[model samples]
Structure formats: C-alpha cells, structure tokens
Target: MTRRTVRIAMNGVTGRMGYRQHLVRSILAIREQGGLALGGGEVLWPEPVLVGRREHALREIAERHGLTEVATDLDAVLADDSIDIYFDAQVTSAREEALKKAVAAGKHIYTEKPTATDLAGALDLARLATSAGIKHGVVQDKLFLPGLLKLKRLIDGGFFGEILSVRGEFGYWVFEGDWQEAQRPSWNYRSEDGGGIVVDMFPHWEYVLHELFGRVTTVSAHVSTHVPRRWDEQGKPYDATADDSAYGIFQLDGGAVAQINSSWSVRVNRDELVEFQVDGTHGSAVAGLRNCRVQHRSATPKPVWNPDLPVTESFRDQWQQVPDNAEFDNGFKAQWELFLRHIALDEPYHWDLLAGARGVQLAELGLRSHAEGRRLDVPELSL
Candidate 1:
C-alpha cells in the first residue's frame, strides 16, 4: 500500500488555538515525531499552508514552524488545486461559514470543537459534508487524555462493576485582564460573538460522557456570568456577556446519571486540574488530570457520618500515574493526528460532524434551560 501525504491549508492560523494546537502542536510536533499514527499503525503528515489575516503574523508563524506556504486570503487558499484538507480553528461564530466554503470546494475538514454555535447549523454542516463526500472531523481531544483514558479502561474492564454515576469538575480561575494583567481572548467574553463556557465546553463533556459511559439522553443546566465585565489585552474594560460558570446534570441513556461543573471563577485546591469520578455498584474510581485512583470492593470503607467527625482514611494513597505506551501529545494534537489518519488511511474515526453536532445541542439546551428557569429535554434533531 502506498502512503499518501495530506496537503493542509489551515484557516485562522493567527488565532490562539490555531497557532498552538492546530499549527504548533499538530503540524510541527507531528513533524518532530516523524508522523502521526492512527490506531491501526496508519500515519499521516501535514504538507501545510498557513492562512491568516495579518501578513507579518502569518509569516512569523510559518517561519517558526518551518512552513513556506503562507496566505492572507481564504479564497486563494481554498481555490488552490494542491491542498487536500482545510483545517479550521477559527472562533465558533466563524466555523459554520468557513466549513461550508471548504466543503463546497471539495476539501476534507478538521475543525475545532463546537463546530457551530447553533445546533441546526452544526447539523447542516454535518449533512453537507456527507452529501459532498468530503470527510469531516471535529476535535474531541479529552477522550485521549491519559487520566480520562485510564478511567475509561476501568469502566470497560468492569473494574467499576455496574456503573452508577459520574461527577466532573472542570476549570480554574482565568486571569482577569485588570489586576493580573492577563485575560482570555476578547471574543471569549462576548456573547454576540459566540463566546461562553457553556457553548465552548459542554460539547466537550457531552462527548466525554458519551464516550466514557453512555450517551446523555437529557440535560438540565444553569449557566451564569459571575464576572459581568473584564478588561481586554490592552486594559480596555469590556462587558462580559458570556457565562463564566455552568452547572449541569445529565441522565444517561441507561438511567445512569452524571453531573458536571464547569467554571472559570474557581480556585484550584484539588490536585486534579480536571477531576472525574465514577461510582459503581461494586467499586469507585476517581481520576485527576495526572492520576486515576481506584477503590475496589476489597478496599471499601466502613464509615459513620457525623458533622463534627474527624476524617479517617482508607483506600487513600497518591494515585500512580498511568504509564505512557506512546509519545505524549497534547489533547488537540492527538485528535488532529487521528483525523489525519482517518483521511489518509480511511480509518474509522468516531469524532465526526454528527458527534460535533451533539455537543452544540447540549450547549444550546443548556442556554434554554437557564432562560426558561427549567430543565430542557435534549432533543434529537432529525436530519
């Protein structure tokens, strides 16, 4: 079998995720590693052309990554007969239109999550990609995290026995631009531009929950904009229209329950940068960003609860880090490699546009839930 190299034109190459994840992590890092491997020993490399708005910024990025092709126009890149894939890491608001154009030009697409801010638009993109016979993928990188991967192994191996529920604690204090002289991108704090934690992250949890446990049948959520305003990179004050915190609960397909708390306002006290704990009939396992600790039936604790009772520990120890079987790649890079494999080798990749649409559905429902002051049923949009 002849191995084919995938020529890529990366849109939004100047943005944060575009530069870091799609460009540096996926392109340069993959080059550093020779090639990106899919599950069945398939590998793909990017023959990349960087596209962005600013000439100097694009040139700097291209030079840093040793890429020679850099462009300031989308139409020029998309029209290029040589490119095989059009990668998008643009803001959520820009994805739908950009993806539509890419598909129309008959290029495969690998895009960042929340493929579209609206569920209907997301679904349309999926359908359009299918009709065009163009492969499309959305990044769902959390599934490849070492800690989350270990938790998944426990679930699949029946170490957790009959699964009960899962709790997810995600996020930390994003530096406010005022006092810390640091801030997230200006667009992230604005609602009109499709910036909100609910829209940005719920899709992540939606897929993670579906992959680790089961598909979420319904979701009930309350989202809040705790910090009403923030300063931009230039120290200009701006009203924050996006939610800074989100509290959500889901009922899985098989009656299992899960809850997720995502916020940018909290301080990190837990060792886990991201914590996911699954409780089962026979045992329980808690996973942090760096470790997964399991408490089997043999180590079950017997306790009496009292408000003033001092804490006693059993089955408590520093969770050992899951050993690496492969080279460590950041979340986005891992998924990018997988998508490239799916393109190059025709491998099975579950991170499709439909999966991306599911995430948008969850976020849209979460917003509706907050607005109506009631739980919104997760609706399946018919194609």
Candidate 2:
C-alpha cells in the first residue's frame, strides 16, 4: 500500500474559528484518523505546517497539536515547493492578497466563506485560480450539519410535497461588556475589521436557501447595529460600528420565500440557538444544528382560535422527531475530507471560488436592499 502526503500550509491558525474548528476538529482529527483513505490501498495524508505572524502562538499550537513544522514568514511558505495546498482561514479583510499569492505559487486554495467582502475581489481570486488550474473551494460548513442533512434527506424522499416558505431564527444574547465579558471578540462589532451581520451572515442564508429550495432571486433586508457601544477585551468601551442584527426576506426561484432573523440583541425563545422551519403542502419541518422535528399534514391538529379558553392540546407533542439513522462527523472535517479527495483523486468538487463570489454577491445585495429600503435582484455571476 502506497500512501501520498499533501502538504498543507495553514494560515491564521491562531484565530478562534481557525484553531478550534479547522485545526483541532478538522485537520488534526483527519490526521488522527489515519489520514484520508483514498481507496485501493492509497491514503491521502494531510501534512500541515502552522503559519501565523506570532511565533509564540504558532509554536504553542504546534506543540499542543503534535505538529513538527511552523513558519512565521508568509514569503517563505509561498516559496516552499513542497506545499501543495494553501488554506486561508484568516479574517475577511486579509484574504484576497494572501490567496493571490497562493495562486501564484500554484497551490490548491481552500478558504472560509464570504471569500471577500466584495464580489469583484472574490471573482479575481477565482480567475487567478482557474488560470493556474488549481483546485479551489470555500467552506460551506452549514450544508453538512446533521439536521440539515436529515432535512435534505426528507426533501429528497418527498416528505415535503411542495415547498412553500421558510423561516429561520438564529441568535443568542451576546452580553454587553457592562455586565459580563463578551464571549466574542470586540472586532466582531467593528465595521473597520470587516464585521457586520450583513457581511457575516447573509452569505450563509444565501447558500442555505439556495441549496434547500432554489437560487435566491430577490432579497429584502433590514440590518441594524443592536449594540452601539460595547466593552472591549481590555474592559474599555468602544463604539460598535458594525451591524449586529439582520432581518432578511429572500425570494427563491421556486417561489419559496424565506425570512431569516439574525440578532445578538434578542434572547432565545426557540428550541435551538439556530433553527430553520420549512413549511410545504404535505408537511413542515424544523431543523436545528443536530436535530429536526417534522409535522405531517395528516397529524396536524385543528386548533380553533380561542383567546378565552386555555389550550389543552400540546402543540409541540404533535410533531415527530426525525431519527438519526447514520453516524455524523464534524461538519468542517467532512468538507475537508472531500476537498482532500478533490485534490488527490481529481474528485468532482463544485464549491469553488465562483460559488464563494456568489455568497459575497448576496451580502452586497443584502446591504444594498437594507439601505435602499427595497427588494434587490440577485444577479448571477457567470464566468
């Protein structure tokens, strides 16, 4: 059995999402699981080199993760001929330039979503990657969630005869610095750092709705800065310039309208921190991160409007839980494995930089819709 190693230069391994999700949960876990089995006695080994500006932090991460290689110089990493992939999990503001460099080096590129804050930059990266003939992908982790997978299965099984509409409620209270130390970084509340609900979340909604129903034809959005002032990491108050909440209405190509509310200001009243309710002619399903509940039209109870009487029937009891018949892996890791196969075995991979640009387009149009107080058309990006 011959095994091949794909050298991966991981940039921005110090950040929260990068460290916890991609490093520990995805790549490291892939390494621990004997790398990716490429079938026929061939294994795809992920040989990762930690790349970051802070030497101490990189060294600490390498030591903790049992990694051998660490590099502080981006130029050196680009110059390294052994590296086959350049992964960018850096902040939204710092992505394009580094990715361009990776493309110049002819490295397969993989990055986080909202590939760039603007559509042009994302398209430019796509152009460079295509010209270089390098495989590229953007992280669409939400598509691989257990609940979403189950929902997709039900949709494929025709549980929903004809999809009609969707409602998504996503948020939990992000504490103001006045009470408790904010869990999220303060930069998330600053627009200068590429932080805003429109930039951050509209991309997710774009892909989710498009995948579940159809392409998003039009968007009507209302975004706001829920907390104007928030305490920083050092306990100093700073003006939060970025929008912290968004209320969006997306019209799908299949005539399904999806309304999603994302907020850090609101308290939770739903079953999960994030949930999407899809209603159709035959059934309705509510999906969270790990669980989904369904209510068929036949089982639906007829509730007469009665403001004067206490409701006796348990509304929640009518819905049946969707069973998890199969095992699930980490969402990011699942995607990582697919990307590895794409590079190693020339597997079919569709989530490319062009797809990422579409996500950026959605956010851009969403912001425009909010500002103009009108619905905006989502133009398709054709290469």
Candidate 3:
C-alpha cells in the first residue's frame, strides 16, 4: 500500500482543547496507529507542524510528542506547498484572520467553531474557501460522542417515532480564581476576549440540533453573567463582561422544540456535564457524553400527580441502557480522520465551512433574540 504524508499546520497547541484533544489524542494517536487507511488501499499519514506564539511551549510539545516540525511564524509555514492543510484551534478573536491567510495560501482549512467571532466573518471565510477551491470543515465533535451516536442510531432506526421535543442541560460551575484557579481560562469570562456562553456553546447546539433532529427555524434566548466579577489568571480582579449562562429555546423544522440551558455558573446535578433528553411520540431517550438510556412507549411508566405523598416508583430504573455494539474512538480524532480522507480521496464531507457559518448565524440570532426579548426567524443561508 502506498503511504502519503499529509502535513498539517496545527495552530493553538498551547491551549487546553488544542493540546489535549487535537495534538495528543487525535493526531498523535493517528500516528501511533500507523496512520489512517483509505478506501483505495492507500494510507494517509498525518505530520503536525506545531505553530503558536510561544516558541518554548511549541518546542516542548514537539519534544513531548517526539515530533520535529515547530514554527512560531504561520506565514513561513504556509509558504511551503507541502503543507497541505491548516488547522486552527485558536481563540475565537484570532481565528478569522489566521483562516483567511491559510485560505489565501491555497491550503485546505479545518477549525474549531464558531469559525469566527460573528456570522459575517464566518460567511466570508466560507465564501473565500469556496472561491479558492479548498476543502474546509469545522469541529462538531459532540455529534460523534458515543451517547449521541446511540441516539442517532435510534433516530435512524425509527425508535423515536415522530420526535416531539429535546431538552439539553450543559455545564458546571467554574471556580473563581480567588479561592481556586478557574478550570477555564480567564479570557472565557471577558467579552473583549471573545468570551460568552452564548457565543461559545450556541455554535455547538446549532450543529447538534441541526444534524440530529432538524434545522432550527427560530430561536428565543435569555443570557446573563451570573458572576459579575471574577479573578483572572494572574489573580487580578475584573468585571465579567460576558454571559456566563444562556437559556435558549429553538423551534425546529419538524415542529419539534428544543430547550437547552448552557452555563458556567450552574452546578451539575446530572449524570454528565452535558446531557440531552429527546422525547418522541413513541419513546424517549436521555443521552450524555458516554452513555444513553431510553424508555420506549410500550415500557413507559404511568404516574399520577401526588406531590403530597412520597414518591415510591423508581423512575431512573425504568429506562434501559443502550448497548454499544461498535467501538467508538475519540470524537475529535474521528473528525480529523474524515477530514484527512476528504482531502486525500475526495471523500464526502458535509460539515464544511458553510455548515460552520450556519452555526455562527444561529449564535448571532440567538444573542439578538435575547437582547430583543423575542423569538427570531432563522433564514436559509447560501453562498
């Protein structure tokens, strides 16, 4: 079998998600597994060129992974025609410009959402990438989660006959830097630094709802910063300008309504940090990061409203756990392989830059809906 090496310029390896998920788990894991095999008996090997502002961090990552290529300048790396793809996991504010440069350099693009800080920039990038005839995609990792995969299996199998609605709860309390160093970066709470739950999570919700259930036709949202003040990375006090929580209601094409609450302030009481409960005419299911449980209409329990009496029925036990018939890989790694295959073998990939723009559009409209205190229509987008 012929082996083709695809060098990927991976930016933002210093960040939490970039380093752990993209660099270590996905790309390096692929290398350890002898690269990705294609349909035509060709193996597509991934070689990562680490790019970031900090040379020391990049070098450290290179040494840690036993990889050689490391660069502080993106333009210099992009100048090489051998660098086939540009992958961005940078901050939202810095993504658009870097993506633009990559597109201009005639490199295929893949990035973490929302792809840009706003819808316009996202659409612009989509248009540019399309015009340049370069392949592009955005990270929609949640869709590939084991739980979501089981949920998708049920959906495709008509288990959720005539789906009615979806309820999603996501997030956990992030410690303030004063008492404890925040799990997330301080920039996540600062609006100037492209921080906000709506902008950060609504993109994820958009793709999940769109791909799993139906296209979101309308949205209504309420957003707020529950923690008005928080300590930064340096133990400095600052006003939290971004919304730490967002409650959104979306209307889907099939008349299904989805309500999702995203927050950094709320404490998680559920089984997972993020979970979605989808209800249909014939059954219902609750899906989280790694597990999915379902209750068919035939087996659903009947309960009478009696808050005055102590509840005796074991409601949680009523649902059955969905079996995992197939082994699941890391969601980020899965998407990376697909993208690599798309570039190598012209494989079909629907989650392109345009799909990413749709996610940004949903976020923008959701924010507007919150500001206006009303539901807003979502228009179809085309380039």
Candidate 4:
C-alpha cells in the first residue's frame, strides 16, 4: 500500500506531555513502525512540526529530536496550507480556543482531555468541528491500557454476569513543587486554568463505565481542595483553586452503580496503585492499573458479617490472573496512534468530541451536585 504522509502541526510541543509523550513517544511509535496499517492505505506516518511559546525552548526541543521546522506563532501554522492535522497538548485553558481556531482553519484536531472548562463551550466546540466536517478526537488513553482492556474483555465475555457495581480506588501523593519540583505542572491547581480532579478524571471514569458497565445517566458528588495552598518551582505560594479530590456516584442506565474515589492526597500501600473491584452474581474481578484477577462463583465461600468476630477471608483464593495481551506504552501514545489511524483509514473512533463531552458534562454535573447538594442529570452533547 502506498503511504500517504500526514503533516501534523503540534501545538504546545515544549510542554510536559508534548515533548515527552505526544512528540517523543507517539510520533516515534508511528515512525518506528515506518507506517501504521489501516483498512484502505497506510496512515503512513506523522510528520510532527513543533510550535510553542519560547523560541529557545522550541529550538532545544527541535535539536533534541533532530527536527528543524519550529514556529512561535500558532496562526502561521494554522494558515499553512500544507498541514493536514492540528495536534494540541496545550494547557487546558488554551485548548478550547486553539482547537476552535484550528477547526476554522480546516484542520483535523487531536487534543488532550477536559476539552473545555465549561459544558457550553465544549458543546459549541463539538458543533463547530461537526459543521466543519473535520476529524476530531480526545485523549481517552486509559481505555487502551492493557489492564483496563483485559477488564473490558471480561465484561464483554460476561465473566461478571449481572455486574452489581464497581469500586475504584485511584491516586498517589504528589510532591510539593517547591522542594521537589512536582512531576505535574503547577497550573493544574488553578480553577481559572482548568484544574480539578472532577474535570480531569471523570472522563476516564465515564469511558470505563461506558465500556465495563453502561452509560452514566446521573451523578451525585462532593469535591474538596484538601491542600488549599501549594508552592511553585520558584518557591512562591499560590492558592489552589481546584479540588484536589472528588467522591462521586455514577448511576448507570441499568440498576448497576459505581462509586469512584479520585484523589491526589492518598498514599499507596497496596501491591496495586489503582484498583477497580467489580462484583457480580456469577463472579468477581479485581483489576489494578498494572494487573487484573478474577474469581468465579465456584470459589465463593459462605461467610457471615459479624462486627465482633474477626471474619475470615471474603475473597476467593483461587482467583485467576488475567493475561496481558498487547504491549502497553504510555496511555497518551496509545490514543495518539488510534486517532491518526481513525483519520487515515476512516475507522470508527467514537471517542471523539461528543464522547469527550460526556466527561465534561460529568464534571459540570458533579460541580453542580456538589454546590447544590443534589443529584444532577448528565446532559447529552451530540457529536
């Protein structure tokens, strides 16, 4: 098959996910394979050109990657007739506006999640992309993860018949930026800049629910800013406007319910970092960020819950390990390749703007539920 090279204009090329994951990891994966296979012709490979804020930083990135073309002006790249796609890894606050502009310029868009801080804005962006007849996608990378994929397979196979509910325990303590220069950027703490676990992570939960259980119809949640203040790399204290943690209940279409506890404050003590436990009438499965285990009804034991009595083991001992299939790379990279393939092969990648909006809507609904102390209906934003 003849390879059709797709030129990609990568915005925010110097940011953390940009230089390391989006550029180095994603583009490198495509390049390493020479080209990705698709239904029609090959997606060829990405020709990623860098665009960012600082010229010096951009130059360093270009030199490090052995690329020469760099642009400080986004408009110039958007205006360039040669570029076929616009890739955005910019700060959350900047993502919506930049993507709107890119869509207007007639370029396909592949951007990071939390597409917008507000539901209305996100919906409008979705409409704009649809009207323009452009390919659009968001980073729902967790779905592509090996562990999560295995869990999805089990659910599809009806390994968990009549799934009762799922409990997700996710998080790890992050270092203060001042002393250790935190791994995540400092801007993530500011609400004005589109920071919050409810907004950032509910998209992940939404997809997981949509995949493992069913679509989420409503959400009731409470959010908190556990650490109200944090110091930046420069040793200057900044008020944290976004919630550092969120506790929410997802009401699925069926009677099934899911409880999600997402936080940045918790310390990891178990063998698995992020664990999702699903219990059903037939069996139960426990999946972590790195592994998954399942136990059938045959192994179920009769036990009585007694507060005074120290109960024996509740879980079965004959739990089987779920085999890992595909080699999982960085989550961001997995989604990147999928998006490019979708564009190249006309493959169905429904995890686009509308799918992304479900997540934003969840956050917006979660915020309203938190503020009003009530359950909020999750509105549908069409693709």
- What RMSD does model 1 have? 2.4
Q: What tens digits encode model 3's per-residue C-alpha lDDT throughout 116-207?
A: 98888999999999999999989999999999999999999999999999999999999988999999998899889999999899999999
Candidate with maximal lDDT: 3
| Candidate 1: regions farther than 4 A off | 1-3, 36-43, 312-328
Count of steric clashes across candidates, in order: 0, 0, 0, 0
Off by over 4 Å in 3: none
Q: What is the TM-score of each candidate against the true structure?
A: 0.93, 0.98, 0.99, 0.94
Higher-scoring candidate on lDDT, 1 or 3: 3
Clashing pairs in 3: none
Better of 1 and 2 by lDDT: 2
lDDT of each: 0.83, 0.91, 0.94, 0.84
Candidate 2 regions with alpha-carbon error over 4 angstroms: none
Candidate 1 per-residue lDDT, tens place, 340-365, comes to 77787788987889999999999999
The alpha-carbon RMSD values of the candidates against the true structure, listed in the order shown, are 2.4, 1.0, 0.9, 2.1
Q: Is candidate 1 or 2 superior in TM-score?
A: 2
Q: What count of clashes does model 2 give? A: 0
**Segments of candidate 4 deviating more than 4 angstroms:** 39-43, 306-318, 325-330
User: What tens-digit string does per-residue lDDT give for candidate 2 at 1-383?
Assistant: 67799999999999988999999999999889888999999988898899988999999999987888999898899899999999998888888889999999888999997788799998898888998999999999999999999999999999999999999999988887877978788888998998887888888888888787899999999999978999998899999999999999999997999999999989999888899999999999999999999999998888899899998878888899999999999999999999999998899999899989889999999888988999999987877
Q: Extract clashing residue pairs from model 4.
A: none
TM-score of 2: 0.98
